[model samples]
Target: MTEPVLTVTSLVKKFGRVTAVDGVSFELAPGASLGIVGESGSGKTTTARVLAGLEEPTSGEVAVAGEHVRGRSRRARLRRARRLQMIFQDPYGSFDPRLTVAESVAEPLRLHAPGPAADVRARVDALLDQVGLSRRAGDSRPGELSGGQRQRAAIARAIAVAPRVLVLDEAVAALDVSVQAQILALLDDLRRETGISYVFVSHDLAVVRHATETAVVMRHGRIVERGPTERLLREPAHPYTRLLIDSVPRPGWDLERLARDRRALDAL
Candidate 1:
């Protein structure tokens, strides 16, 4: 069997008295997509942060491409970053205001996938094109582009290093449905073409169903339910999972009832 590109074993994170993540565990197979779905404060973002080495875990283990991301030193974190990367929610904020999109993408190439200047330029151009951005888009700064455009550029930067895994924390939550669909398609295509695994963290179940093959649903920092994404959506075993599915706005969705349900669930 192929080794998993990413692994989490009993991961936990604490912020003073608050436990942001508790015993969260999952695995991402090579070229596979796994969703970590939850409501805000459910610890999905914290889990992603820990996996990407942005937040040190209070406890537990995370391994990316056979290496630990728990390494405390800057060199160890940077070395782990070469194997794993992240695309955060705010696209425009993720990049330097002073840098053009090309420069932003080129930074990783220069660091992790170092090559001659010409080769780096060529790679940046190819990455921009791969994400459906125009060559002219590369010349623009993050603030100069639309949200969707900036997101594509963020994705380009994240993938520029050819990392084995990507942890996307609400990567599409900031976009409209159309733009979200486009980004999701782009991610799917990239996974198929490059064999890159994904750890997609989001509160939106719709996005999870569309993007991931398997998922874990979190409530209050612990995984409440987990299984194939389709199955969980269809036959959720936990009350929290059922609540999440019912919370999605559909043709017949009743907002008042869902609000009540969520309140009751939260009280538990």
Candidate 2:
């Protein structure tokens, strides 16, 4: 069997008295996609942050491409950046406002795979094209592009170094329905083309279903249920998973009842 590109075991992160992530663990196989699904405050985002090394794990292990990411020196951190990258919810925030989109995308290439100036520009152009960004969009600053465009640029930046894995924290949560679909499709295509695995973190069940082959649901910093995405969505055994499915907007969704039910579940 092919080895996993990313492995996270018994991961825990605490902020003082509050445990932001509790014993979270999962693995991503090469070129496969996995979703970390949850509502707000469910610790999905925290898990993604820790996986990307933006926030250190209070306890547990995170290994990317067979290298553990903890207590590493500056050189190791740089190597980790080349092997793994993260795309945040706020795409604009991921880039330097003063830099144009192309420059932002070119940043990683210069750092991890330096070449002649012309070669770097060629690689940047190819990346921009791969992500479906127009030349005009590439030339514009992050603030000048639309939300969807900025996100495309962010993906380009994350992939510039040819990272084996990507930690996308609510990567499409900020976009509209149509834009979200587009970005998800783009991500799927990129994964197929580049053979990169993904740790897709999101609160939207539909989004998870669309983007991932397998998924794990989180509640209050712990995984409540996990399985193949379709089976888990269709036959959720856990009460929390069922409640989460029912909470999605539908023809007969009752906000008050779901809120109360969730509260009751929390009390259990």
Candidate 3:
């Protein structure tokens, strides 16, 4: 069996008296995608933050490529960042208003591996192209682009460093259905091309189903169900998971369909 690229053991995060993440644990093999699904305040984002090294865990262990993350020293933080990067939900705010797309993507590369300006420009252009952005788009600020364009730029920045794992916290929740599909496809393509792993956090089950092979359902700061994404969503064991799956709106799932199903079951 291939070793997991990312592992979380008994991870817990507390915000003073509030227990945001409670003893959550999971693993993702290299090139695999794992979805973390839950409603608001269910600790999905908190877990992603902990994994991304943005928020220090109150207690627990997060290991990347078999090496356990240590103290929050500068070196440790830098190491964690190089091993894993995060794409936050807010694409608009994630980038600086003044810096253009290329500048934003090149910022991390320069910080982590500074080199000649020409080399950085070359890498930035390559990354922009990889994310389906034109060289001209690289010169535009985040506000000048559409929402989907900004998001693609954000993805470019996240993958520019070639991190082993990506922690995506509601990464597509704000986009329209069409744009969301495009972004999801881009993410899968990136995984295939780079062999990178993902820890996808979202409340949207349909989006999760499209992006992940395996999934974990969280409710009130604890994992309630976990398994292959198809099986878990098709036959959710936990009541909370069932509620989440049912809450998603579907075509032909209106009063008429519900009544029809009720009548069919009654006749049976």
Candidate 4:
């Protein structure tokens, strides 16, 4: 069996008296896409933050490519940041309003890559093209672009460092259905081309079903169910998981069709 590219064991995080993430644990194999599904304030985003090293865990272990990363020094934390990149739900909020698109994407390469300034520009252009954005977009600022464009630029920045893992925290939740499909396809292509593992966090079960191979359902800071996406979506063991599955938007479900779909999916 191939070793996991990322691993979390007994991860816990607390914000004052509130327990944000309670003993959460999971693993992602190289190039694998694992979806985390939950409602707002269910600790999905918190878990992603912890995995991305944006938020330190109160007590737990996060290992990347066999290196255990716990509470390390500032320099060590920066090194770990290079290996794992994160794409936030709000692209505009995550980026600097003052920076142009090219500047934003090149920021990571500037900090991590040792090369001439001109080389960084070339790499930024390549990264923009890789994420399905035109090189002309390099001149535009986040405020000048559409929501989808800003999100695409954000994705470009996330992969600019050539990270081993990408933590997508509701990356597509802010986009229209059409744009969401495009972004999802782009991410899939990137994974195929670069072999980067993904930790996808979202509440949309349909989107999760379409994008991920494995699924973990979280509720109130605890994992309620986990397994192959198809299996869990079809026959959710937990009551909360069942509620989520039932909530998926389907056309003309009425009653009989819903049963048929559930039966067909369960057989998988």
Candidate 5:
């Protein structure tokens, strides 16, 4: 079996009296896509933060590409940062308001690989194009762009360093439905092309189902259920998992249609 590119074992985090993540453990194989779904305040974002090395865990271990993340020296932490990048929920908040889109995307490359000025510009341009933004977009500031465009620019920056793992913390939740679909598709394509492992954290099960092969359900800082996405959705094993699945809004599914669909499935 291939070794996992990212691993979290018995992870725990506490914010004073509040337990944010409790003994959460999982592994991500190289290029694997894992979706974590939970309601707000369920500790999903905390887990992502811990994994991305943005927050230190109270206990347990997080490893990326076989290197330990916690209790590392400053140099070690910087090394980990180079291999792991995070995409925040709000793209605008993450990007510098003063910096143009190109500068935002080029920031990582500059930090990690400071070389010829012309070379950095070329690489940034390529990353912009990779994320479906035009080279002209490089000149525009974050405030000038639409929500989807800003998110795309954020993605461009996230992958600029070619990190092996990308932690998406509610990355698409803020976009409109149409833009969300497009961004998700773009992410799917990027994963396929780059073989980057993704830790996608979201509250939307429908979006998770569309984007990920595996699903882990988190509640109150604990993982309640985990399995293949289709299996978990079709036959939820945990009560919390069932609650989450039932809560997904299925448009046009009135009581009558729901009953009919249940009956049809039962007949199968």
Candidate 6:
């Protein structure tokens, strides 16, 4: 059997007495996508941070392609980075204002392992094209691009190193719905072309439904329910999950009734 591309077990992170992430666990097979869905403070971003090696877990295990990754050593972090790259919620904030888009995209390539300038430019061009950006877009700065364009550039940069896994934390949250759909489609295409796995963290259930093969529902730092995205959304077993689902605005949802329903679910 093909081993999973990413595995996380008993993951926990704490800030003082508060547990930001509690016993979280999941797996991502090669070319698969997993969505972590929850409210603002439900630990979705915390888990993503731990997986991406930005934050050390208080206790737990995270492995990429069967290799354990944790610890603060420069070597350890770099080694982990070779297998995973992360895309953040704000593309503009992630990019260096002084660097042009092409330069920003090439930064990872040059940092990990420098190559000839021509080859680097070619890779940057290809990555830009792959993410639906034109060669001209590379000349522009992040500040000059639209939110969606900046995100495409961000995705290009994240994938330049050819990491096996990408951890996306609210990657499309700041975009318009149309732009969000475009980014999601770009992500799907990238996965198909590269055989990469994605750990997509988002609060948007509709986006998660369309983006992930499997989904995990988080509440107060713990996973309350998890399964295939469709099944879990269609028949949510946990009250929190149900509440989340119910919270989405539908065609004819009554606000007053929804408020009452939310109160009832919260009481449960």
Tens-place lDDT digits, model 5, residues 1-268: 9999998999999999999999999999988999999988889999998887788899999889998877567887778888899998889988889999999888889988898999999999899999999877779999999999999999999898889999998899999999999999999999999999999999888889998999899988999899999999999987667656765667754666555655664465
Candidate 6 lDDT, 59-161, residue by residue in tens: 9999999999978898998888889999999988889999999999999899897989999999999999999998888999889999999999999999998
Please write out the lDDT profile of model 2 over residues 65-125, one tens digit for every residue: 8888776578867888988999999987768999999998888888888899999999999
Which residue pairs overlap in candidate 2's backbone?
none
lDDT of 4 by residue, 1-268 (tens): 9999999999999999999999999999999999999999889999998887778899989999989876668877777878898998889998898989999998888888868989998999899999888877778989999888999999999999899999998899989989999999999999999999999999888889988999899887999889999999888887678766775767764676567665765565
lDDT of 1 at 31: 93
For model 4 the local lDDT of residue 230 reads 97
Clash list (residue pairs), candidate 6: none
Residue-wise C-alpha lDDT for candidate 1, range 1-268, written one tens digit per residue: 8888888999989999999999988888999999999988889999888988888899999888877776779789778888999998998777999999999999988977677999999999999999999988899988899989999999999988889999999999999989888999999999999999999999888889999999999988999999999999999999899988897778988989888988998788
Deviating ranges (above 4 Å) for candidate 1: 254-260, 263-267
Summed over model 1, clashes come to 0
TM-score of each: 0.95, 0.96, 0.92, 0.91, 0.92, 0.96
| lDDT agreement with native, every candidate | 0.90, 0.90, 0.90, 0.89, 0.89, 0.92
Per-residue lDDT over 234-258 for candidate 3, one digit per residue giving the tens place of the 0 to 100 score: 9888766765665567775566655
Q: What is the lDDT of candidate 6?
A: 0.92
Q: Weakest 10 consecutive residues, lDDT, candidate 3?
A: 257-266
The lowest-lDDT stretch of 10 consecutive residues in candidate 4 is 253-262
Overlapping backbone residue pairs in candidate 6 total 0
Candidate 5 regions with alpha-carbon error over 4 angstroms: 251-268
Better of 2 and 6 by lDDT: 6
lDDT of 5: 0.89
Task: Give the range where candidate 2 is weakest over 10 consecutive residues by summed lDDT.
Answer: 68-77
Worst 10 residues of 6 by lDDT: 253-262
